[model samples]
Target: MRITALAAALVLVVASAAPASAAAADGTYEYKLLAKAKPDECFNGIGVPYPAGPPCAEGQPKVNQAYVWGLTRVGTDIWFGTGTNNNCLTTGATLGATKPVLNADYVCEYAESQMVKNDPKIPPEIGDVRPPEVWVYDSRSQRNTDLSAQIDKRSTDDKYRRDHTIGLRAAGNFKDVVLLAGPTAEGYVNVFAFDARSHRYLGSTTYTGYGNVRTFLQYDNALYLGVGVGVNGGDGGAVLRWTGSLKSPFSFDVVASLPVQAADLSAYDGRIAATSWPAEGSVNAPEKMAGVWISPLLADGLPGLTTEDAAGWKQVWNARQYEPDKVTAATYGMGGVASYGGYLWWGSMHVPMKATKVHQKVYPQDTDEAKQAQVKGTQRATSIFRGKNLGTPDQKIELVYGAVALPVYDGVTKTWSNKTTNYTPLFGKSGFDNPYNNYTWRMVVTDGKLFVGTMDWSYVVQDIVSGGSQVAAPDPVGYGGDLWMFTDPEQKATAVNTTGMGNYLNYGIRNMIVDGTGGLYLGMANPMNLRTDLTDDVPEGGWELIHLTKSCK
Candidate 1:
């Protein structure tokens, strides 16, 4: 009898193991390659494509633009925004010129000036701005339409003479209209309206304060905008509420302000939650580090009763309180935030290229201290946190996803404590076990599941190599942005798709939206014009729009 029971147990073990292995082999989701943008697509209806050579020299047959940064769904059609390869404009120019320009401060400006001088058709006021293109894909008809010209016409600013609009930063459906925010030169954020029913372009409103509008959310019948002060000078960041009729679309009210840049804003549990960039300095900094704040719920249960002051908001989480001993200071600027699974989910931002010493004095990149700082910055994995009962004072917050267990530092004691405890990483340590995938660009909840999109810097490392930088290459596993879905609350994260949805040039999944019909759309970020060297499949590097759906067994 004992032998027979043992034999049955062995049989059960084998049967269970076989199914688990097969499931692993089958993968959780099937990926379909949807569409690819070409180099000529950037020039479509805009301006003539620059002749091959010199500054505009081709990496492939045709230099491709990168990023389908903006994505939104209206009815059955999906609208995506594509960004130009600003790197092709100048060797030093970066996307949105985010980096601090040291040597030639205006390389992109200089290149634009030269392009205007050469091209007869191109106006000097517009310069050589290769504005982002807008495309609409009709899922019902399976057709695509280029709406770049219509969007451009509505955003034209004769005062600035800079008609070239960058990629759409945020998009949403509000009151039967699709609102799109596009930023141009000199801290101008242009908001455009489109009739979703007729797919027609409406008028646009241009705001002067914020350089870029990063995120948008609709609550309490009002559209809230999160604006960032990029390279342009401003009084940090502000949250603006749009409360106007169709006839007067430009009316806005400033609701809140922060000392640093406002990274993102989201509506959660009848209140608005916001995150900001880190302030300067280390131990005794004048301004506080990045933090999560919730506005007091008004009588209408909306988040706009107070102005931009301490008394108007309640602080929830601060990076300094969670800073690890490995780094001098924690600059935990929050990224995407959303309400999911009975909790508010938020992600951290840790871009190594943007990492710098936050305490004491600025350290030079060549010094050992600076190099260690860079490693420490990269080691600061993007963490995912969840808070339950967000608005109430009894709210609880916990780290749901992260890899490293950094030792907590005690300011008064001046010692490292809790080295072995409380530093639990839900995800395995080391950049979620993929070093290059550090920044969580966006997060969204759909069909009762949480999906996270990341920005992998492995391609940026390769771009550095192609541009003759001394930094070593990153690991192969870290090449592309990864999409992770949290379905079973108890199970590990399921990787839906990883190969940048078939475009290897895609380094970041900047935006994602649900199609309302059981489908998810992803926007790719491939800034440095990448082409597939192995095959001629895509000779020019361009951004791609990818759609994901569950496969039938």
Candidate 2:
């Protein structure tokens, strides 16, 4: 969707994920945007569509890529704030906000990422939502405020750890569209629901699902959260639910708990959809069912789970049996979530599953060229794969659910081609941030289309962009690191379109939120101040606040 000069005054949004078109922007990094936003683009329980890009407007560089993290959207306008201070940039020098971007522009400017000081040193099993109050590039109000405090006291509690920002979501009409963020601790995930009117925290609640809730979704008036429980013998992963009821004196209830060995997810429909890795693995080994799951969400008050069910949340939906294939074993959600048109969609890291020819002999991907050759007597299953059906039917066949069961993304060709020729964006690190193909961490669908970003991949880019990958900063950088645009109509990955928007936040790109005006906003790491690691420029360096607008002129 491009905005003409006349249209730039407001904001126009379009459907993406269709067979749109565009050329890869020149490799040289130049930030671009089309500023136009719709009214109900935020928290309306509806979505706006985005056409493929290549035609968005080009703009002057916006702040030269501050290491910003966590993006939050206020109304149609976008708000971005940085995270924790490095407290040690160079030679152990402390780095915190010296005076952040209050409100920068209608065009995309300001900085975000913040280096966290008291960031919890938790296990990799949980998700952290710290560095409260994702900043709004205050426009008319001017001077950014810690709006998060209105929602979380943690804003003052320096001990609180807030990492990335997911965008603003509608909780209910009366209340503000819920903006989701995380706090670090042993087993607590904070949800600071805000009131767009008062522009303050409506009510802040934390869930003790015993697991670290990764992402969230609103459906059927319920808040579904993806909580990950370590599989190394502890509680496995599960999806916890919360009803959007402000009253009733209830803490929070576990809606439908979907359990698995290692899982991370975002809520959609009755179930929480996510990406899994290996389709099949030893009963003990984890698979990548990063596929999709639609667990039951309290069917109209079907004896909703009680505290008694907490311990038994394990019985809710054994995530291990989630997708017959169990594809996402190790990667654990490294992908995002998307629910559109009654269908759930996700992408996997394609962590190969070792299969024998016997498995291939009995069952072929219908497009197995070698199998086809065997029919012509040109090849034999014995030569192709002669062994045993390593993966059971349920696991293997279940993995192949889509317009085309066989999914193949050729990083070399930069294309996603499936068995039946269905296509989608072929995004990767080569064209992406480097080190790894920009394997998107999460995805969001607006008006029948999809958008995605890489969490860890962006960290890789930060390494190179910062000068070199010398572990200059901490590895696997912060959230919402990089952003990648794509069209996922039929599910096969297709056109790979990185916008005129460069890596505004050299940090990890986290949640993707569409605003009331259809502008795309992200919650990421606090814009970084390269005090210790890169030793780049600041005033120019450090975290930031970034906004993306697409205009076709």
Best by TM-score: 1
- Provide TM-scores for the models: 0.76, 0.51
Global Cα lDDT for candidate 1: 0.58
lDDT of 1 by residue, 1-553 (tens): 1223323432332243221110121254555556776544222112344455423343233334467766788778887766665443322222223222111101123334444556444434334345666678887787888876775565345222224455566776666677777666545677767777777777766676777677777767677777765443145666777766555656667776666556677777767888766654434542446667776664443455435332455557766555554343344667878777777778777654343333212333444433433333324556777787765778887766654345344445533344432546555543345556657788887887888887766555443323433223233343567777888555556666565665545667888887675658888776543242334343235677777776666
lDDT by residue (375-485, candidate 2, tens digit) is: 221100000000111122422112212122222333345333433312222332121323222335456665345665543333322332333334322422222244554
Per-residue error for 330 in candidate 1, Å, reads 5.8
Best by lDDT: 1
Clashing pairs in 1: 282-359, 403-429
lDDT of 2 at 88: 17
In model 2, where is the ten-residue run with the lowest total lDDT? Answer: 378-387
